[model samples]
Target: MNLAEEIQKRRTFGIISHPDAGKTTLTEKLLLFGGAIKTAGAVKSNKIDRHATSDFMEIEKQRGISVATSVMGFNYKDVKINLLDTPGHQDFAEDTYRTLTAVDSVVMVIDCVKGVEIQTEKLMEVCRMRNTPVMVFINKLDREGQDPYDLLDEIEEKLNIQVHPMSWPIGMGKSFQGVYSLYEKKLLLFQASKQKLDDTDTISIENVNDPILNDLLGQSSAAKLREDVELVDGVYSDLDLNAYKNGEVAPVFFGSAVNNFGVRELLDCFINIAPPPLDRETELRQINPTENKFSGFVFKIHANMDPKHRNRIAFVRVCAGIFQRGQNYHHVRLDKNFRFSNATAFMAQSKEIIDEAFPGDIVGLYDTGNLKIGDTLSEGEKGMYKGIPSFSPEIFREVINMDAMKTKQLEKGLMQLMDEGVAQLFTYEMGSRKVVGTVGALQFEVIQHRLKHEYNATCRFAPINLYKACWISSENKKKMDEFVDSKYRHIAQDKDGKRVFMAETKAWLQMVQDNFPEINYHFTSEF
Candidate 1:
């Protein structure tokens, strides 16, 4: 296919949700529809003797939680779909945030019982800020949960997004019948199957009051569905593709991901309406997906994907044109041109080398430790892509070496993990004391686990007396030098050798800011 045709036929999106909200299960079901996997892996259960495909890391499998983003690609209904399963735990928000930049749209999973949790709210806020197109999947309907209408209201209020219900559940819990797909005007009766998804009994109803619904489901359940449909229609306007594309509206779907009920409805509607690869903003200009020359950006760098080989893969989202293997492309940050002989596409951790990839696809490039997060590449241009920034860390701890003989390994692992964007590593100028900063305490555990298993390095985290880490710069070179000299104890450099001030307290930071008005302290690395 031509570049335009290829771009039009591709869909790239990220799956996000709160922990235990069935996000991974929903991904497995979607892959099932796409014929990517033979049988769905049990997310939290070991009965199947399998773990979630997205949870490929050993730590993830043991904890039953996703700590890193995993990419999977497949073809369904003649459309190439690139799905990124992101960590739902708040500790990995940095990684998830970067994943959002590579995706054209988002599928937010919410538990029917919990509605919207704290992590879900924060993730939605990020999407709202970027005006990213989103679709909601209300998961786990087989279990007794909140009233569907009440859950929808909670989502609308808490998420701060107007929601249009594309599909509504008939009866939840033990009385659960099925879901009515408003988009296709069909009724899909629910069935409990722990193994895989089978073709459910579907009946197209041009009319909601059709007698077949009553015959299939009891009279009361059928009546409730009709009443709910009428109320939904009266309350919300019809789904507008343009409004959804603009991120002004979200189309919601209800389902039990584990049972594979109502998942097809979500996937079918998604492939039909979800926006394809759109233009990405760069420092120069917006690069359209239809452009003839290849241009893409690296949003994530993962280390030790294969612990034995100690492989690090740079995940690049193809933004424009076609990426041909062995073709030389300009690395904008490094200002060098290089050719990649191995460009692999992902199915969780397993990958196969591909000769070419098109826009809206994520291809992994093998790295020998040079790639960093937010690095941009192009056919020949020198411009960089914008909007990929690291947020200031909320937690800080000093890394204490546990094995003296492995000090070099410890340092190597720390630097490599920092480059993966999981945390920020800083070094004290005088003593060279290494400190790690993260969004949550859990990240320290993930890093520690990776350090031992993958890097063969061991270290313990000791609490450091620091409130925040800020990158400081100033137009006045003399003043900046004097500030660094005055606060020598608090001076440090980040992984990229950028100067940082390790604030002892908020009051102290405020005092310094007031005293040195000319000096600028940026909480995020964007400036």
Candidate 2:
């Protein structure tokens, strides 16, 4: 296919929610329905012998939580899909935030019982800020959960997004019969024989009063379904595709992801209404997907994807034109041309070395300590893709190497994990002490686990008494030098070698800001 045709035929999005809301399960079902996998491998539950394909890391498999993002692409009904299943825990918000930038839209999975949780609200904030289109999936319909109307209200109130249900549930918990797809104007019955991601039992229903529903769902369920559909039609407007695309409204669906019930309705409607690869904003100007020149940016970098090799992969979302293997692209940060001999496109467990990829595709470029998060690669364009940033960490701990003999391993692992952008690595200027900073306390545990297992390096974290880590800068070379020289002991260099002021307390930070009016204190590294 030609560039425009190829770009138009792709839908790239991320699946996000609070941990255990069935986000990962929904992702698996999508892949299963897309023909990317057969018979679903495993699940997020730890008791399962095998695990979900998206949770590839050993730690993830063991903990039953995703600590990193997994990019999976597949072809469904002639439309290419790039699905990024991100870590739902708040500890990995940085990774999830960056993944949002890499996709054109999002599929937010919310547990029917829990409604909108903390992490779900936070993820929605990111989507709202980016104006990324979102589709809500109220999962776990097989279990007794909240009232659908209440859940929708909570989603709207907590997430601050208007929603229109494209599919209404037949009933709640055991009473659940199925969902009626408003998008397709069809009634999908959750039949035992049709319990598979790829298939569902459906009957064309031009009218909700169809008698077949009464026979299929029984009197009570059919009556409930009829009442719900009438209320939906009366209270809610139709799924405004334009409004959804603009991120002003979301199309909601009801289903039980674990039972493979009501997923096909989500997928079929998704392919028809969800957006294709859209335009991206770079530092210089907006770049259209149909642009002839290739431009992409690195949003995530994973270390040790394959346990057999120490291979690091940089996940780049192509923003425009085409990216061809063996073709040199300008690395905006490094200011050099780099070519990839082995670039991959993910499909759950399989990594296909594709010859070329169009816009909206996430291409995994194998790297050896060259690319970092937010680095842009383009057709020799100097301007970078904007908005990816490293947040100032809340918790800081001094990392002391226990295994002196494995110092190299420790350093390599630390640097690599820092490059992954889950946490920030800082070196104290006075004692050369290594400090790891993270947004959430859980990241410390994750870092510790990965270091010992993946790097075979042993290290202990010492509590560093500090309030915040602030990146400092100044146009006045003399003022900056003086400030750094005076506070050398409290100064640290970040992963990118940018000087950060390690404030011991809130008062100390305020005093420093008051003292040095010329120096700028930044919470995020993007500035």
TM-score of candidate 1 on Cα atoms, chains taken together:
0.99
For model 2, name the residue pairs that clash. none
lDDT scores of the candidates, listed in order: 0.91, 0.88
lDDT of candidate 2 over 379-474, digit per residue (tens): 988999999998888888999999899999999999999999979999998989999998788898889888998999999999989898999999
Q: Distance (Å) between predicted and true CA of 40, model 1?
A: 0.7
Which residue runs of candidate 1 sit more than 4 Å off their true CA positions?
47-49
Q: What is the TM-score of each candidate against the true structure?
A: 0.99, 0.97
- Once model 2 is optimally superposed onto the true structure by TM-score, how far is the C-alpha of residue 308 displaced, in angstroms? 0.8
Clashes of each: 0, 0
Off by over 4 Å in 2: 45-49, 191-200
Q: The CA-based lDDT of model 1 is what?
A: 0.91
